[model samples]
Target chain A: MTGVETLIAERSASATAVIPDIAHYLLNAGGKRIRPLITVAAARLCGYEGQGHLALAAAVEFIHTATLLHDDVVDDSALRRGKAPANQVWGNAQSVLVGDFLFARAFMLMVDAGSMRALHVLSRAAAVIAEGEVRQLAAARQIATTRDQYMDIIAAKTAALFAAAAQVSPILAGASPRVEAGLEIYGRELGLAFQLVDDALDYGGVAEALGKNTGDDFREGKITLPVALAMEAGGEAERSFWARTMGEGVQGPEDFDEAVARLKRHGALDATLEQARAHAARAVEALDAAPDNVWSQSLAALAEFVVERAY
Target chain B: MTGVETLIAERSASATAVIPDIAHYLLNAGGKRIRPLITVAAARLCGYEGQGHLALAAAVEFIHTATLLHDDVVDDSALRRGKAPANQVWGNAQSVLVGDFLFARAFMLMVDAGSMRALHVLSRAAAVIAEGEVRQLAAARQIATTRDQYMDIIAAKTAALFAAAAQVSPILAGASPRVEAGLEIYGRELGLAFQLVDDALDYGGVAEALGKNTGDDFREGKITLPVALAMEAGGEAERSFWARTMGEGVQGPEDFDEAVARLKRHGALDATLEQARAHAARAVEALDAAPDNVWSQSLAALAEFVVERAY
Candidate 1:
């Protein structure tokens, strides 16, 4: 099993029994487990061997799970990973509170890592995660969302933890500042690539294949990269379509299809894919500072794999 | 002005502002500003004269506000302090994200405080707050909720922060361990009293008088101290009433009135009040260890005031 799978198997029982039933429901349902992979791989590449990385890996997973629970509630999403969301199965109140629990549990795991540096990095990331969510909420589907604004949102909500995962492992492993920065850059780029592709997939990928409800961003009226690019590229027809579909709640599934078509027609999805590729390249470039070894190669390979996934 | 009042005045602004109005919204919205008061009051009593207290105070408030936003979204609460809740006014998505922003901003304020000790205290409290929230959700309407279970919940959610606020100030002031422990105990007692009275007020106070929907806990089937005590004392009649009302969310205004009458008749409400009084006494006793001074007196007065308010 992968480090993430191993960590999940170890802690899936007993330690979090209060939330176990719901956690089992969600964890078994499906997810990429990409965040935890990033954490473990980063640690391995940084030459960490004290087993503290296992706790940190679990912490990353917990934080990601917490965000998903809150996200489902915030978006009022009924479905996730081709299954009923935790909020849908249990209720918003339970999902939200449970999400809080995971966040707390994650922090506890970090504390167990026994480094003030780890605490500082993770805490800052936690705060940034919240800020990013807020900024995204404020931006919503505004047609005026600048690239800078988009960068800020993604940096906080998506990349911050990934960067921390990469940087912290090296820091704990007693890597030099230069090595830490390289890993930080690698994780951040990988995160950016992952998020960009996610945005694109929401606009273009098959729902069943992706294991999630596609065109969800459009349904939520979220001004993601593809939609922004499509609006910039498309004529008045596309803009009107975007305007109608990008409201707080979905009007219907029909609108989603129409919006997706508009995105494809404008080459917005392709552009987003290219953006992901660019970040993936940057991520690979970041690992050059690390000494050449099997672990570094694996880390480099993982970044490519993140971008290579079709769904 | 009082230290807390001055802090509030310095930060206060109207919540009504456009997106560009970050600074304004950051400052205002008429929070009781209780956390800062606790922090500042503790600092002063501990003989802290440094400016570090100001940032810590703001950090605590930010954390509280962030949780409030998340709580409103989680509860689907429409109103807060007689105004439309963040979720209601800005939508759940906005509220959720903005709540995250506040959480992150709180960390920034703490980082500004520049004390690793302060950060450790606050970050741990943040995690505990989330844990308490989860515990409350898990324990909701659990008729068998033990006193220990309830204490665990409050300690994580409420007393943790109180302890952080009180103890952190003394630590920053370089006070002795005895002084820190004294302040921590004081804050704990105060928080317990405050939460207990809050439970009482939900059932005993009027909606107009409290400026919040009265008996919300009952309607939501939240097993608070009064409810727990009532459950323990209740005969078959009360048990049936609880069975029909709790978790069913079927309690109307008349049902609320009937529930209060049951509590009063069973002497649960009185018992709870006595408990609150005991806690208040403990809170005051905690101040005895501090140097006899105006700040210590204000803290004692504040402890009394916390239980006195119906709202």
Candidate 2:
């Protein structure tokens, strides 16, 4: 098992049986344990040898999973990670209520960790995560979403948790301010790279390979990074195609294929990939101020691997 | 303006703008401002002369609005209080994020309330509320939902907030223990009564009078107190009716009317109303120990008004 996997495994039974069942269902469904892994890994890098990191790490995963569950319901998504979503199996009501349960359970677990700093990190992250979702909703299909707006959305929605996880671990480990800031930057950049790659994959991913439904974002009228860039670069032809395809009503499979082809023709995918790589490099750059350790090196490698991973 | 409206009338610009939007959306949408009023009235009974109750009262309203936003999205509810819901207007993504934002902003506001006691009451209530929602999810359409189980659900989902609203006022005002306990019980019983009335109203209320879609509970297949009692009273015929109706897609509108008629015949509404009245009485009973002030007398009258007005 991976280090993060072992940590999740060890602490999986801490909450009520019902909570663990949903948590296991979500975690085992597999979309990468990147954020919590960063938490544990960063703590290890800071020369911390305590097991409290395990609970805090699991708390981070629970928070992320809760957001995902709620997000899927909001998006009316039918598929995720190549499987029927929790809402599909259990219904939206269960999915949402369980998401709430997971959120509460995570905080309860953090309280057990007995660190005010941990609570602050997790609570503030919760607020930012919510703000990011709102930002994305407000930006949806507006065609006015600039690169800065996109960055802000990703920072709130995706990167905030990752940043909290990395920065928080050092705080838990009692590291100096300089080291904490470095870890925070590393996590934030990594999260940006991860989300950009996700946007790229959404436009171009093979469903079988990526374990997620391709083209659903376009169908739902979501204006992701690639689409945003394409809209910026596209001439009248591309612009009209976007307006018609994402406007409303039933979107045929052909429309999806055409949108994907348009994205490729505009070189939006390559540009998005370049952006992802830049964020990944920036993540590594942030790690430079940290003391050398195996966990630090692993986190840097993980940042690189996030962009490289097919799914 | 209602008493609560008068309270909201006096606030800062930003808070006034945002809060009234939520309050008007809710109060005009017509949720009995039972929770917040109980909060303000409780503070008054405890001899709290300051106007800080207005913010606390608004805090209670915000929490209630946030939950409704999440609940409607979870239920995919198209209608609420005889109108299109916030989710219907803004979409589920916006509703969910706004719900979260409300929750975060609530805590930020509470922090300014500056009493650790208030924080404990509200935070613990938040956790309990989440747990209650989960319990309701688990019990949905289940045949084995016991009355005790129902009580637990109501306590968490409804009473927890009411209890916090009432109890926190006393805590914030630095009331004695006996006074705090008295107000807590009053809120608890009142919440129980309020929820029972809601369950009954789902079957018994006039669409125009309640500003609610009639038979919503039945349509949603929720396992409310009335349905649970009726199910227990039901023979084989009624049991099968419940199985097909609650939580499942309806066969047609006529089928829905028939199911509601069956519920009425079974005296489910009466049983629930009687239970509600009993709780209202119990709530007033708890207030006997409170000092004979205008606030205390108003709260006593409010308890009686809950069961009576909800009917």
Candidate 3:
């Protein structure tokens, strides 16, 4: 992980001042290394000690960081990871260009990872992530967004990268295709569970704990699973309430409390957590093919922690 | 070029509706395909006849297209290629995401080219292009920008990709190292020539003819060589005029005309053209190491056409 950090810091450096400035700002913002952690664990569990894993880890982080920067801009977000986003700090134009710089830099780092197969996986995942984002945008505020649709969105936007990252270390290690497939399932399922918990926390958790204000998804007219489920389970009154706040984009100050109250009344947050738990269990189950090593054990614990964060 | 277009259309397709929708719109907009032309010319001139060159050509165009999409958003322009830009039609958020999709798709195509060396060249160029864009933003509207600084910006943002695209086909062809380096120089210098002509035409060309409104750089306070030269040559009143319009970010409708008059009076446009001509000649000269085939001759003529656009 330190090697990954070192590679990130070194690779993100550029003669262009704002390229480094914005990259440093976003990269140093204390982001969770969940993706890199998965890559490292997979490497260790698969008995790969080559330095390519570190570079792959760094490339994965770069992909994550670049997407974060662009997502902030696309969402017009003001803060990320509890501090001012790079877009807000540097302005949108520089943010966009710097995001591009980081993205292009990620491909270069992947090349350095020295596996064309891993490169293909990561690059394809990147394209899928972009597709997922576009689909999510098209579905935003459309209240009729289905659970299946929402799942597809998350699978593409968030879980695909996780799957790709997990697949990389094993591919680099020349591990069996079965092992690679198992780790990939582990990653994708864990990512789905993690995102479900995140979406649930947005409706149920405190702002300080979450490092961002609650009701942002609500405010942005973003339809996550909980909102979709609640909307589905509710009657006319609930539909109109959601329609006014999210569909019409006309939220008053007190509207968030009402939204939350409705979520609680319908037990949507609990159901969402339920969905998350099932996914986490599947993530653990996917690891049955791997050896019963401490790394795999740590991975199972991490899956549990992801769902626990909802509490 | 048709093969390149076919590949772009095929690769940009996604299960998500808007991914294909926006991509189709941008890729179908009758772009000049000059980058593909350059790639094909290089490949043919160097005695290469592989499908990898076609994939590389498509990848090169994808990189160019992706940058153009991002550039339109970063500039917030309303028009591209004589039509409403993708950002305006689909909105900025979708434009940004689709741009990412195209960029990632470019890498996939490059990987399909089956040459890691070419992949490295294009990826590094993409990063440099982003860095150049950021550097341009940092140097934007600073009336005191040096000529050398202006050169650096264009070289990175415009010429680097051209150079990369030029190098790819030759690399796939397994041309001699000296020939590879020579083609790279040809590409970079031709790109420099192309961008210089673009800048000059932005000041001197008509809006309808250029497919974009002139005076955009003046309005955006983008410091190009002509603007730099005009700023340096101006008197006290001229300085204040430029300072007010570009430096202070204030522009009136009449200011564009007055700015053009100043450009003519200072011979800034002509001097810029001279600089472009020098680059074009250098571009042609760089191809001397290659076979004296029609393709190389066509490249030389294309360089002339690039500079001729300014007139």
Q: What TM-score would each prediction reach against the true structure?
A: 0.85, 0.80, 0.98
- Cα lDDT of model 3 by residue, B190-250, tens digit: 9999999989988886678777777778888898998888878887777888889999998
Ranking by lDDT: 3, 2, 1
Over A213-300, each residue of candidate 1 has an lDDT whose tens digit, in order, gives: 8766776677888888887887787677667667444367577777777778888888888989999899989999887787888878
Model 2 chain A poorest 10 in a row by lDDT: A10-19
Per-residue CA lDDT of model 1 for B1-311, tens digit only, reads 25444543443232323221332343455557777888998888888888778878877876777677678766654356666675666666666555555555555556556676777677678777876776777777666677778777877778888778887798789998888889889988888887888778888866665556776788777788877777777767677788778856666668888888888888887788788889989989988888889999999999878877743
**Per-residue alpha-carbon lDDT of model 3 for A226-272, expressed as tens digits?**
89989888978789999989998999999988898989889999999
Worst 10-residue lDDT window, candidate 1 chain A: A9-18
* Model 3 RMSD vs true structure: 1.3
- Better candidate number, 1 or 3, judged by TM-score: 3
* Cα lDDT of model 2 by residue, B4-122, tens digit: 56544332112213333433554467666778888888888788877666667766776787788888776655467777887777666666666665665555455445555675577
Q: Could you give the candidate ranking by TM-score, starting with the highest?
A: 3, 1, 2
Which candidate tops TM-score? 3
Between candidates 2 and 3, the DockQ winner: 3
CA displacement after TM-score superposition, residue A226 of candidate 3 (Å): 1.1
Return the clash pairs for model 2, or none: A81-A211, A82-A211, B221-B246, B221-B247
User: Looking at model 1 chain B, which ten-residue stretch has the lowest summed lDDT?
Assistant: B11-20
